[model samples]
Target chain A: MTVSTALPAVPVTAALPDKKNRRGNRKNSTLATVLLLLGAVYCLFPVLWVLIASTKSSGELFSTFTLAPSTHLFDNIGDLFAYRNGLYWRWMANTALYAGVGAAVSTLVSAMSGFALAKYDFPGKRFVFNVILAGVLVPGVILAIPQYLLLAKVGLTNTYWSVLLPSMISPYGIYLSRIFAAATVPTEVLEAARIDGAGDWRTFGRVVLPMMKSGLVTVFLFQFVAIWNNFMLPYIMLGDDHLYPLTVGLSGLLNQGANQPSMYITVVTGALISIIPLVALFLGLQRYWRVDLGAGAVKA
Target chain B: MTAVTALPTETRTPRTATRRGRRAGAPYSFLAPALILFVAFFAAPIGYAAYLSLRRVKVSGLGLGAGARTEVWAGMSNYARSLTDPDFLPSVYRIGAYGLIVVPTMLGLALLMALLLDAGRTRVGTFSRTAIFLPYAVPAVVGSLLWGFLYLPRVSPFTDVVQMFGVEPPDVLTGSWVLWAVANIAVWGGTGFNMIVIYTALRAIPTDLFEAARLDGASDKQIAWRIKIPIVLPSLIMTFVFSLIATLQVFAEPMTLKPLSNTISSTWTPLMKVYRDAFVRNDIYSAAATSVVIAVATFAVSFGFLKLVGNRAFNQED
Candidate 1:
């Protein structure tokens, strides 16, 4: 199903000869190593700080050394869980549902649309593609207010559909899927499927989807992270805290931290815990995060 | 394949005609979902925003009953008010300043890190790449909160270290420094993603090109400056345009930081102003006008940048 499986293989050593480059690049390599390490430390600083900060009780948070770790990690999690009758867990679950379902549906829609645009020579293809390209440029935040108003007219605002529906259509995902479709799925295979009496739907299901599997993973992850990280759409749409995603919930929690300093620990703990699932997902799918913005431009 | 080719000419022609007929309708069926959603979400909202921007609520008397507060044509009045609103211009200026600070520094660092990573002379490549890109996984809200705490004097290691040296650490969450403090969180969160983008483009370049340059006695820096950068210029331009667009829509970071800081106002950015106008002030007309203005300006900047750069990034689509 992966794109690599479709390609002819080359000898491994010829493709990646590691020993030769290491011997001559030693001197400058040290400087590059140091600079990269510095960048890594800079990036990791706040994350490390948050980890330590979350372990501190509200009292130790301000009084103790900034880097000092404490034994309040479990207590902080317990406290965060107990806050407002396990609302934090609700937010976590809502975020998962929103991201997981939204991305899954969005990916499928993108795949279908992309496959049509790529494989079939339909009327208005250029216009359809151009419109979607323009969609990619539109500032999504600008659309939030109008989306909210329009949804409210139908009384769909403040509901889960308000957030989930908007998250479903991603122009960028469709655009990327088109590129993937053109690159990975061969016309010959599709033609073969058609000759064997497979319908268009069957061809897409059996032939196209599996071939674009890796590329679709990239699109799914992009949309997943985007929906997971989105603040405005849900913040503007949903009023019920139970329907709130982690971003909105945690933000509201920090807003409360202004009145009660103790809420700061809860916010910090919430922030720390919220990031773990995404960070794990990100790391696990590290190799698939190949994003080349100039991909179409380069080929053309 | 053999079966398809071995079919009789008359039979094949009829089947081909039927297949062509089916193919004509197939793409539309496949595209139905995306098109429906696009019209409902993207096209409709934009049209409604534009329509609402041109109209306003006309209160006949005390504005009490249903018929009393009727919607009517306001023409350019809402647009005029939005443009002339005192909070609007300053937010624009502030965003201008923020973008000026964010786009270059972030992209510059991204390009540097990408070049370094592509150099293949580095140690702990995986660790460095992972660490730098880690911030991307953290939502802007959480990233802002983490930095918000880091900016607080009582809990900041920077403040602690400065006190150890008998020097006062400047408070980052107050006065004008808060702007850069917010900008710093953005740069920190954004750089890694941009770096990975540029690095992906760099990896796409053929290795023999670099091998040829090295054989010609060109240093790594020389190869990067003269060859690699020029080659990835398209990606750089694309990233720049995307970064510019993102910079204009700054919201979550500042909103998250509001609780921790005194300086960031309800109208700190243009989007925030739109939010305040629509929800807080209950003025949808003006909000719609401002949203249109922001959307138009984004289109202008994006198109203008693309045109300036020969529109190479998207010209390939045609």
Candidate 2:
């Protein structure tokens, strides 16, 4: 920054940000690199540990260095797959179902609510949005027991809906959606659609939905990771082991590791297995991770 | 769909206003699902909690039969007991200390990582960003599980790596380091989202701000501290409030770590106490009171923090 100020004829883009600052940028970048690497190590170490530990046989798990990879990789996964009628796989599928389906529906719900809040000037719009603001502050723990009881009233407790239903309406998602709708979807287009005799629903489906795609993706990922990582809700909601998501399942396995030490290996293996898809999803979908979700639609 | 229609000086314009009046109902219809869910899952729970907090079953002589106990109004006794409990205060203090450690460091690391990523400086920014965010994908339980194993003497690579140097790995899940262990899990899970948020706000800053700052002979560090940080302070506050709220409700990591360590208690944090009251002790009344306290504290602290910072990002209504 200072170099650009100090120099007269530096090409702006290639502007040596500040010749003196060049040294600073280099130092800062180095510090930044090291800090980032430290963060990466902090994050990746445990994951890396799990990866390596998952490969070791139960015997080797406690006998050797933790980072040393063993040849029992396939065996550990095979053992995990074989355990309790392949409940591990069921948990994985259930997690995918929870996160994937939950996020999709959540995104739709939030999108609709946000669009309404942003686009329509309704009598109770302010009131509704304020309620959402309050909702955002309400902790999930407070709702868990009540959600269970409410679902129990409808005889839906322990069912997938108990978990899925509560997750569908994310206040944060709705908040983000409103911001996106207000910023991106111009009122003129909706008015034009109205002038062309398109109904509100039709216009929303055709014109508004497309404009909201990017923001919706962010909403989807947020809800996706949230539901995927959620432990307590499903832990309380689902009783059947078959319905257990990875978090609850792995935790259960870890609790058993207290008594049966071999389960530690399984828990380690399961932890590694559980993280694979989400990490892959996060990495693969990096393009969709709009740093500015609000900005995504601004271009539209 | 209001338009300044090219109209003659109309005798009356109530038609457009009436049309808008009729259309106004449509937005509520769209918002109905969210409202219904909010009422059912959010409002009703809170209402129920508060209601139940005021009532508790009192058993008579033997404390035996179905009708032996009757729900009676306990007034604010439950709240008083919960508030005054020795365990409660320490848990709050622990969470305060934990929050102090987790919030700033996590947000700082996150902000720095975000700015570095945004600067497009290094080759591994994308990789490191994803690696850092990878924990976000890992559920707190799973992250705790992974970290818990890493902290174990037998499984820790640090244990083995240091054994070569004739030293044991520090018992991270014990002693003062336990806080760091829990905070580390939080930092890992939280930093990415906060980073993304602060990054979003940073990205929202008009480039002209940077261009002008650059023209002022500001260094990149100065530009970040002066221009970027101030511009994104709202985001920082937003993340801070969210982190503070989340820290208050710290649950899974410690709960998972409890099986691995003797250090963590059932009431390690406030919500953990709430969980114990709600589940283990089957004392939802006091649990409800604790929940109310936590919710109020969150609102008050978040609101106070926002007011202090004068950040209005969360003040949006509809």
Predicted structure with the largest DockQ when compared to the true one = 1
Candidate 2, superposed: residue stretches over 4 Å from native = A1-29, A291-300, B1-22, B164-168, B212-216, B316-318
lDDT of each: 0.87, 0.77
TM-score versus the correct structure, for each prediction: 0.94, 0.89
Which segments of candidate 1 are over 4 A away from where they belong? A1-28, A297-300, B1-13, B315-317
Tens digits of lDDT, candidate 1, B1-318: 121223344434576668757877998999999999998899999999999999999999898978998999998999999999999999999999999999999999999998887776755566777889999999999999999998889988888788889999999999999889999999999999999889878877777888888888999899999999999898899899999999999999999999888899999999999999999999999999999999999999997888887866663645
Show pairs that collide, candidate 2: A3-A18
**Candidate 1's residue-wise lDDT over A1-300, tens digit each?**
222221112223322322343223544478888888999999999999889988999999988998999999999999999998999999999999999999999999999998888887767988999999999999999999999999999999988999999999999988888887887787768767877878789989998999999889889999999999999999999999999999999999988888898899999999999999999898777777777887651121
lDDT assessment of candidate 1: 0.87
Q: After superposition, how far is residue A118 of candidate 2 from its true place, in Å?
A: 1.0
**Can you list each candidate's DockQ?**
0.52, 0.36
**Number of the top-ranking candidate, with TM-score as the measure:** 1
TM-score of chain B of 2: 0.89
* CAPRI quality level assigned to candidate 2 from its DockQ score: acceptable
lDDT of 2 at B260: 93
